[model samples]
Target: MTTASTERTARTFETIGVIGLGTMGAGIAEVFARNGFTVVGVELTEEAVERGREHLAHSTGRAVSRGKMSEEQQAEILGRIGFATDLSALADADFVVEAVVESLEVKKDLFRRLDDIVRPDAILATNTSSLPVTEIATANTRPGRVVGVHFFNPAPVQNLVEIVRTVVAEPAVLADVEGLLGRVGKNPVVCGDKAGFIANTLLFGYLNHAVSMYEGRYATREDIDAAMRFGCGYPMGPLALLDLIGLDTAYEILETMYRQGRDRLHAPAPILKQMVTAGLLGRKSGRGFYTYERADSPVVVADDRTPSTDDLPELRHDIRTVGVVGTGTMAAGIVEVFAKSGYDVLYVGRSQDKVEGVRAAIARNFDKQIQRGRATEEQKTEVLGRLSGTMSLDDLARVEIVVEAIAEDLAIKTTLFENLDEICKPGTILATTTSSLPIISLATVTSRPQDVIGMHFFNPAPIMKLVEVVSTVATDDAVAETVRALCAKVGKVAVSCGDRAGFIVNALLFPYLNDAVKMLEAHYATADDIDTAMKQGCALPMGPFELLDVVGNDVSLAIQRELYLEFREPGFAPAPLLEHLVTAGYLGRKTQRGFRDYSAR
Candidate 1:
């Protein structure tokens, strides 16, 4: 058990009392009040009490704005809260939650006072994201009642309420808090008292890792944010989320977690510390990664505080023609994106008719755009004029780039590249849209290894914003630079990384997905429960099993093996359940059988 769980054994809080009336404080009070519990909102002064009232009012107003509540309902919820100017107001309360400044001394002193005033059975809770809950609990005679209920920002809006139980906390107190959270319509996830608890433990590591990447100049902020949002379906990217969570809060959380866990991954990026020291406290301070209009303002105003990096050298290829090698959905999409970009596209496949069928599908897509008034007939015709199909690579000799979009078979891609090397010019840029392949081996096949690079585009390339610009040691800087520039020209965000299996997205993503599978294999939870927990509990786009069905069990298994081979970590080992599914040919939506049978669909 961590400090949070330890602290819970010492404190007792009930008949809820809330000390401090900041945004978080007022939200806490409102949560308890809305659940039909009497609330005591303690503030330093009458003016501060009024401010807390305004905060509560606005929070409820937002609920009305989102159609989640009515005006009368909001008033009824507000009526239960009783505001006061003295700590003595909490004397008779059963529980007192401190939502004041994040100073450890301030919280400890407040808990010490509450310990003196409140009844023996009253529980003491802290909404501190950082700081040891144990330290606060031990400051008083009855420390067993102290618990940490870490709620995400805009507390009422976000549904997750981390019910952190300290070791000293009685089982009954923890159970009561869980029931209280459910009464307020918040899903409580129980965890031991730790710096970040469950959500922050998992979340901040990823965010801090992204910040470190930016600090190292690995990728631009825009590209980093875009990669996760577009490539991973996150509602907001890590940097943008940092801005929302506030730089100072993030730094404190990281620092606390670092001290507690001693994990380098939890260490705050130097840039984060510097930004906080500079007073760019995110949306709360009107400045962070992106500036806001004013303190506490929701509107983000543009500023030049964003970092600048040296631009990659521009790539210049000799010819203009491009050879698109494939006949699958991805191949068709790649051909369409290239053709729409006004390139002279030579879509090579085994049959001319197959190539023409893709062309016909592109035409229908263009017709749909015209029908929707998003494209003009003349523009559609112009786009179609740049596309052509061929059954042979004879016409590919004059092409500037040979993009292999064929099935992910090494032997097939090697043979095609070998043939292309014999046919194309010496300096022709060789690019592959392979999501999971070593560009080094592919580069070795050709004399112009420097020109070979990976331009891994997300599915439905035209709509997706991210393109992983991968480079091998043999790949020329100019080749990588050109691919990034081309990606930008096509309205895509490009994040460059060294050539590695899974690159960025799949490397981080597949593990989490695989872990979800393992959780199911262990019978920890049902597939539906896990999916709902991730979606409603963690705010993900889709649950793990749902994504597996869409991505296909075969593909997920292949990627897992690749990751395991590269990392050689026991944790990354492919789950036997996934292997069994693939072996059974229950490969997901395509096979119509995976975690859930989809044959009916």
Candidate 2:
């Protein structure tokens, strides 16, 4: 299985057989037919065959309507696919792929039958994403020809296909399959017949962690989703993707992985089993983590049970004024966020020049937005007009709330909080945007400990939708609610939590990045290859190294150190390679010398 082939005979599959006609199977059939390979799709009965035919028709019709293919092309494509109620129609197929349910017994039974039906030299493949391919191959007499060709969802569009081979698999068999898939414009990667293969082993573990977090009520679903999307730039939140994947399917995948690997991370959340037992099978059942407009529609209906402040007092007092400290990019972004939300913003800087610089940076951001057609000139002017800067701390006395977005240093923030304790008026809310430092420490410095809370905003606050509202042990619940409401007023999703290092996002994210760095340090794969594996294999918006570069290795190292210091977990320890890179002043995109070269940009 580990052998690499230099000489390979080209294999041709004039007819490909696909078992099961559900969404995944039908999509696979469509892919083969569209690529000019004759596809024979088999179902249990004529009714099942009709359903498969209808699915193929609907998908191809969508392709034609989207101008991805012509009507004539669709007809020609459809002409290549034939549906059958019996498996006998696949007797002449050169290759057979099983895409049925993820049950091991069901797959073994089908492979036993296919072993007797197909030609002696024909190749048999299973599309199982989690199960051990070697075990599946054991069902057949000729295990050398059995392989796993795992295709991503919507096989026609996604370019990646993980080809899994067992120890007994002949290198020639993989060479043939690779050539065939590559000829059809698919990116083929070969790996051992391990559980979860390459992608799901990494992806499903992270997803299961998200599910476990939700099950523990660590954060609201919306906030968890927004934090990843806004903070890490994932295309979809983990819960949303799980819903799309179907909770039942995810549960099965996790179960198989946990059983094979015996790792705690692969364990499925208990809530998943409960939901599946209740028949809440995600989009297929019209309800899972979220409610959809229909069983198959992509539109998510607004949930009526969204988190609200009904428990807190009715503090509906409109926030008319806000203040932000520091002259860094986050500080300037905070000023822009408040100003754009129709609040008069007071920006406090270290000096007059720095105050002027913050105001200039805020104005230039608006100007860029206007140039990009994202905002009108009048809108930019109004937003900029709402912002005012000053060098004195007393200037924030009249503001309803003062959000401290200064350096991540604890001493600097504690000193600022002490000043705010003296300078601000009574009943004013003081919030800190410290990423890792304890909010309680800052609260202790203030005379009004109940008033200080953590309101952490991601980079470029105006664009990111997530705002974590942290409440210290002494902080008032009403103050936390008020801060949450203020986040809503500014069009942000606020997740409430007790003060802790890394909060929710960084706590979960940095460990994964550190794992990737460890993988690189071990030479398991090159940085570029690991990044590609994550991007294409797991569907992340950016690979770990890519994100590390943009996030600044120096910043990541600090966060990792804080998490390690607080948790004292060996897993949270910063990678030596990461620390070395930071020590070398390779501070990511800022220095243009992180994992990947960005100086060219």
Number of the top candidate by TM-score?
A: 2
lDDT of each: 0.81, 0.85
TM-score of 2: 0.85
Residue-level error in angstroms, candidate 2, position 500? 2.4
lDDT measured at residue 304 in model 1 versus the true structure, 0 to 100: 76
Model 1: per-residue Cα lDDT at residue 1: 56
- For residues 1-601, what per-residue lDDT tens digits would candidate 2 score against the true structure? 5878766457777999999988889988998898899999999989988999999999999988999999999999999998887788999999999899888899988888887789998999999888888888999999999999998888877888888878899888999998888878888877666677667766777788788778887777887787788777788888998999899889988898889878666778899999999988888888899888889677888677565445433344447899898899999988888888899999898888999998788778878878899889899888878988899998888988999999889998899999999999988999999999999999998789999999999987888888988889999888887888888888887877778888888877887788778767866456775676679877788888998998899999999999899978665689999999999999899998988777887
* Native-structure RMSD, model 2: 4.3
Please give each candidate's TM-score. 0.77, 0.85
Off by over 4 Å in 2: 1-10, 43-50, 64-71, 82-92, 109-121, 138-145, 165-175, 189-192, 230-235, 291-304, 307-320, 370-387, 514-539, 564-587, 597-601
What 10-residue stretch in candidate 1 is worst by lDDT? 5-14
TM-score of 1: 0.77
